[model samples]
Target: MGEQNPLCVNVSTTNSTTEILSRYDMINWVNDCLHTHYTKIEELCSGAAYCQFMNMMFPGCVNLRKVKVKANLEHEYIQNFKVLQASFKKVGVDKNIPVDQMIKGRFQDNFEFVQWFKKFFDANYVGQKYDPMEARESTIIWGGTPPGPSRIGHNNKVSASRLVHATKPTTRKASGLDSKHIGAATQTAGGAEGGGSQKLEDLTSQVSKLKTKVDGLEKERDFYYGKLRDIEVLCQEREQRNGKSVGTEKILEILYATKEGFAVPEDHVEEGAAV
Candidate 1:
């Protein structure tokens, strides 16, 4: 709704012939334009950056309110893409966003689309300054523990340590009391330790279960990655036999790509900040 008419409406017609932008160039362009710290193109798969790009080019067209900037799960990533696709339709951009391939976090699919987008952005962006963090601040859902592996495990370990500390028996200077009372106190202390031991065992079991679940997920991920790699190798051989103009060349690029664009000097690399 921000801009009813498309600005660079002619950009799409020439997109097929648009020169392939290098990975290093695209990465820097995206990071600079979006004020994001993405070193890898695959990180763009979350779709938040793309949504923001549209909003930057055509303000208010993309509902920043709908994008989950901190999305990690596949479904959450899909939601971000949905917002992006809707915005594209609204703004009259006819680009075919390969959401299916892009969401897989594959470099090639994302690279191809991002390359086209950079071309689109270049033609349309009028060099206006936009702060992506400020634009997206309202849209970030605030309550979850940060995205990554096992904050759960860290939390469980901390809780287990606290439980053990709280349940530990402390020795007291004996006030003169009957031996019976002393024995009773000892029995009560022993019972408390027993209860603590049981609770500790329960927590241990929970932690073990969590660990097992994580391992299984890792194996599943490896399995799919291996399959994708196999397919890439197969396609590569066929492409070589058939020559470089194979129909699936773009698809193969998506599979074959493994590097994170170009190398940044060790001193020049900027670390990503937390959202």
Candidate 2:
């Protein structure tokens, strides 16, 4: 990407309608005011004697450390203001207010900016209150065994045990019948699996044949491309050789015409000798 040109501003001491100042000029003026005091308009416009009147303001609730943090935040705000100034310059606006005046007007009747930063700090501060009782309850619920009927419930436990024992051999006989059925299913499945494998092999062979044909076609295409390139080179060389020959023929024809025009007549030479 090409580099963008820096924006230039025309500075005027007198409040003249002819000369228009830009947002960049206002930012520069504000930076100048931060350094020194100015009496003359040209001195105000120039780098020498502009005033430093603004100081950092801190909330009563915050400590010295918080004040330092707020100072950093103010620096970031100034940087953002500079970026806004650049955006205004890029779009070439016709008019602009001074940076200090704009800030003053925005905060004149409102404390919203200050209140917003206060709320931001309050929300982000991470001093969570600890609760020992709640933590213990949670640990017990997570780590302890689940509550239910114990082994001392004698009648119910004994009855369940007898019922499980009585059904055991009947369960074994049913499982034996299921095993026989599964053996027949296995034989049927083996036949289907063999048929699927054969179909897969046929597909694989067809794919290999198609791949070989495509490779052959690609090789043929490359061969034709090489031939076309060679033909183009030969045509260019022939045109160049023909052009040189034509130029030489034209030069020789001009020389022959000049020689014929300059030749002396035989009768004129005889008349001069007689005289």
Query: Across residues 1-275, which tens digit of lDDT does each residue of candidate 1 receive?
Result: 48577544536535567876666678778877666655455667788888999999999899888888867666788899999988888888878888877776766777778877877887788878787778887432211111232111343343322222232211111122233444554555566575776655665565556556654554454345434534544565576578676466776555434445643333211211222
Q: Tell me the whole-model lDDT of each prediction, alpha carbons only.
A: 0.61, 0.31
In model 1, which range of ten residues has the least summed lDDT?
Answer: 167-176
User: Which residue runs of candidate 1 sit more than 4 Å off their true CA positions?
Assistant: 1-10, 13-16, 138-275
Candidate 1 structure, TM-score to reference? 0.48
After best superposition, candidate 1 residue 21: deviation in angstroms? 3.0
Minimum summed lDDT over a 10-residue window in model 2 is located at: 47-56
Pairs that clash in candidate 1: 108-254
RMSD of each: 18.6, 43.0
Model 2 residue runs over 4 Å out of place are: 1-192, 244-275
State the displacement of the C-alpha of residue 261, model 1, in Å, after optimal TM-score superposition: 34
